[model samples]
Target: MAHPYLAYYCLNISTIPENSSYQSSLSSLLSSISLYATSEFQFNKLQKFLNISDPLYGLQLCHGDVTTEVCRECVATVAKSLAVVCSRKLVALIWYDECMIRYSNESFFSTKNVLPGFALSNIQNITELHRFDQLVNTMMIDLESQASEVPAGSKKFKTKEANLSELKMIYSLVQCTPDLSTTDCNTCLQEAIGTLPVCCNGKQGANVLMPSCYVRYEVYPFYNIIDTAPSPATGLPPLPPRELEGMMNFFFLIFF
Candidate 1:
């Protein structure tokens, strides 16, 4: 029951006319994407609806650490919301905590997109500012390397934890759309990591969301560790499970 973190519409582009052929095609494209995303239990899906008048390209992506159930639910929710919130728009993108959905009249597949990105940071700041920043940079750089090195057809995602102090720890996750090449994924994540200091400097937690990739770090465990396997190269064991599912259920109960 996560709500949308942000949404973007192509305001510069003209909107589709009501009851036009392009509008009808858009509806059908959304329906197909919704059905396939929910039924396939996939972490990522890219779809295109071909029409002589207007073609639509759409993509749906769930965080790599999310469960199939959560992924399915998130995709379904965003798909329905995109149709309503960006009704008649030629291009739009929506981001939820667990998933993101995007559609455009022009295809953006396999490209690195950094514009129209956003950053969100917690209000609380870290007391050890310089030291914390160094750690975040090191950990994020390592994670970006790991995530972007994945083989073709594998998920371009990685997570890591680092000790900030005896009582505090930093948890981070980074991911790129699976469709991107290794070089493209690395570039996308690198650009995203470069923005932390400008937008989130020393906040306890922050996230940068782009159309091609995202990176996040928190003082507390915000991602599902159980679903993240240890990287063979690192020789690290999987982290213990946290009460994330229960927290999600509670969130849904209160919000939905």
Candidate 2:
């Protein structure tokens, strides 16, 4: 079996000019995120705004199927990577197979900005392209609706499967950060699903990942269907105070 914990991609947006206050604010924001990862996982998503001099804002969302421990690991990895890879960037976003982490100078909570998202598709084309397109369109629309209607305080996520043939099936998953209202979540997912024709038409499998939301479908089962309940949030693992110093050193070693 494939390991459930993996990283999919990373996005390093605009950079921050060398400003001491901005750097200090970003450092504090990173520490806050690390602490959140160590402690909270119940909702599988977190959105926080730091009211510092620079006002850094961030959001982190984990795939609902993963355990709280897995979510923590993914968050830690991204936090470390971003500290180095996006050291000077004002906006940094990273997507792990199990979770996502983002931080920026501007506020993005509950806002739907879908540009800069990426699409990936299998190289193999489906023989029944037109029919497959129709099926995907219908299925994604239904999933977008279902995912947006999570029980109060639960993760905004849903997974479903559609039969392409007796032996062939298409598995789909859709999710948004729980902080988003139902309407915003639906809108974000709808926009992503609508881009199927442009990005993944005729491919056997495809996925589009955005900061606010992401939609994925594949010929094979890729999600854990058995565990539908969300994990409870908690505190971070015991870390020596020097851990942050080490993280900072790691970033500097890589870029400087």
Candidate 3:
């Protein structure tokens, strides 16, 4: 069977040649950071921008759940693989594994840009339209609160549990590159949130992703918490049922 998270769609923008230096630097940077990471950001002015002629740079934040080896491997693949896949497109994206990679000459930082993104239905949907709307809307509200209250320093991504009732629960996650301005990040995600009704209307599971952010909800946990890192009792509550949804079908949105 296919690896988890393999059946997902993606969206992104990348400025390759102009940002050659950015990709080069990205390769080096990933070689340094530990375990899984999920982020897409541009480089600081001090660092050499990827492509000289373009003068634009790229940045990325990997999903925090990934292991160091996997993150490095994924990034490396983007450096090589994207070149072959995207060919000459200045802005491109590829959904490779649980790792989504993208590079763009555009100032993606703090700037919210969305598109007519896509969603692959799970061959399931509720017959009652009204009930469906309520379920999706309510779940989104809960996820929004958790995302805003995300604890970690750089990672503003969160996977959470919502007690729909004693009998049922929902697993969800909301994430934005820490570099994103709250407004831009929130807006981009809100767009993804908005897509639920239109695209995933009745589907049992869906991943709504935008260029700068994404939200996912399903019956199972879809993350690989890198460590036994105890969550401090500040905002995020314990994984409901105190169970780590081992083995995630991560929907990484790659951009090149």
Candidate 4:
């Protein structure tokens, strides 16, 4: 089951009054977003409920590789949970494994938000620290570039893998909300990547989750390789051989 990794509410802001116009609008907004999950056009929805004097702006995003069924489940889960979890705050954000849901009294669309981010890391540490760190940094930088270069309407997501040694490999993924522009997406990713050394340096695996974008890496594959495309939307070329030479093994080693 998908669980929330983080839940943030703007505590300084006033909470919505029970049965008020704002509350009604919020309910309608979330309901519409959840209902749209069944659509085939895209896995995200940016919506607003403007019937009331105070409007509510919201968005829902599912990870690029999840199935439609999973996306629907995740969206529904967060939509219902946010109201209770956030205590009817004027602004709130929640992150789940399969999806993310956020809403505010004011419009936040197309803006880059990085505050209230969180990081998760494996308890185990890598034995080969320096080499592993170098490989992860290189791969993440490449993935960030590719993910952020997509056109505005396309999914800004990318995944990559590299063999760290004959017995081990590294898998990574980076993503941004499609609504963000290329420069904003790139900036968000860079900030997320900068958190690794502070939060998960030398760990076997780690994830940086932000409101605008996220970056993750692990020794075992945590994402669906088949569900996601192998390249970004712009068809950018992969890292040159010289850049990856001596740091990564292109061939996969199978152990029976």
What ranges in model 4 sit over 4 Å off?
Answer: 1-7, 10-12, 39-41, 50-52, 229-256
Clashes per candidate (backbone, < 3 Å): 0, 9, 35, 0
Tell me the whole-model lDDT of each prediction, alpha carbons only.
0.75, 0.67, 0.51, 0.76
C-alpha displacement of 93 in model 2, angstroms? 1.3
The positional error of residue 59 in candidate 1, measured at the CA in angstroms, is 0.4
What TM-score quantifies how close candidate 4 is to the native fold? 0.84
- Candidate numbers, best lDDT first, in rank order: 4, 1, 2, 3
State the weakest 10-residue window (summed lDDT) of model 4.
247-256
Please name the candidate that would achieve the greatest lDDT relative to the true structure. 4
TM-score against native, each model: 0.84, 0.76, 0.64, 0.84
lDDT of 3 by residue, 173-226 (tens): 677766666566667678777776666665555676565667766544455433
Off by over 4 Å in 2: 1-14, 17-19, 38-52, 151-153, 229-256
Candidate 2 or 1, higher TM-score: 1
User: Candidate 3's C-alpha lDDT?
Assistant: 0.51
